[model samples]
Target: MTETARDRLIVGLDLPTIADAEKIVSTLGNDVSFYKIGYQLVFAGGLEFARDLAKSGKNVFLDMKLLDIDNTVAKGVENIAKMGMSMLTLHAYPKAMKAAVEAAKGSDLCLLGVTVLTSMDEQDVIDAGYEYDPHTLVLRRAEQARAAGMGGIVCSAEESAAVRKIIGPDMALVTPGIRPAGADKGDQKRVMTPSEALKAGSSHLVVARPIVAAAEPLAAARAILAEMNGALAR
Candidate 1:
């Protein structure tokens, strides 16, 4: 599918307060249409904030990364489905994935399986007692997610091409750790440029600090969107 700039980008609202999030949205205005509300904002009672965004016609990607038993995760998915969210994320464990798929059966919610965080490298995977490297684990979990009927997988751009080859064309690949050229990598270990990630078959790019911490967040977002549009055109 052909994607517009807004369709391919997701801005992460990792701020601590709803007021801060409101300010950012007001600053960006219609330039941004998709927002990710993760644990920090949700823990700060940003559910109402998220609902307001949805009511204003913005897509909400709830990135809580649900990890729990099948029953609990199913219940959680059911609850979120009623919130008019566009997408929801959960760990790519088989039982959790199956439950999530079942819970979202009648809703418009897209269940995204988080394969591996962009912040973890091979050594970190080893330290976590995983026998495989980061790339290998991402592939394994992605396959599991697809098999279990997830809408997509959350992976880094570094592995997006390989994942695309594995999962085929229809599934979504939401990539994070998107750094512009010369931008700080922060705590992210597996990172890629916005164009690189798009070329590697990322369906959507999740960018936070680069845009949020910029001297001018609107300009930063516009530049990234232009970069994404360029990549899609190629």
Candidate 2:
């Protein structure tokens, strides 16, 4: 099925408390249909909130980025699948991806392999003891994710085009660090505009601070959705 701008935009609920997250969701209303619950919100009773959002027909991307021993990772994925999570992320380690895939079988969960973070640059990767640069490593992880039967990839839009070639047309290519034109880049080093990210082959864009922290959260979300619509029109 074809996607709408609303479907492609995954707002990151990166708030410190459940009240803040709930307030944003209520404010955004039906204009925003998809949400990403990351570490910050997840710690503050976001899992139950995530399940609640799912019950209300909102798509939830549970961004846990799980990485652990094969048994541990598989066990977690098994439960996340039952939680009705639309999507879940795990570090793009071959073993973890493989285990997650096996655990998520028979469910609709899309297990995403998180590649190098957008906040990390070549220096940061090297500092972490990686030989390859950021781009190369992202593609390598994409390949590994595909080989392990992962349903999608989580990568910076900067590498979406190259990664798309590796994962092909069906797999989901979810990108973060999406800064709208003229917006603050903040700590994101590989940020791209929403239109640019979508045109670059990103299937979904995860936005947080721009909308969640905006003075008018709904307006900020509408503006982004407009931009995404414009891109999809082309």
User: What does candidate 2's lDDT look like per residue over 1-234, in tens digits?
Assistant: 238999889999999999999999999999999999999998999999999999999999999999999999999999999998999999999999999999999999999999999999999999999999999999999999999999999999999999999999999999999998899999999989999998989999999999999999999999999999999999
lDDT of 1 at 14: 92
lDDT of 1 by residue, 1-234 (tens): 338879879999999999989999999999999999999999898898988898899999999899899899999999999999998999899999999999999898999999888889888889999999988999999999989989999999999999999888999899999999999999998899999999999999999989887899999999999999998888
Residue 11 of model 1: what lDDT?
95
Name the regions of candidate 1 deviating beyond 4 angstroms: none
lDDT of candidate 1 at residue 148, scale 0 to 100: 94
Q: Pick the candidate with the highest TM-score.
A: 2
True-structure RMSD for candidate 2: 0.8
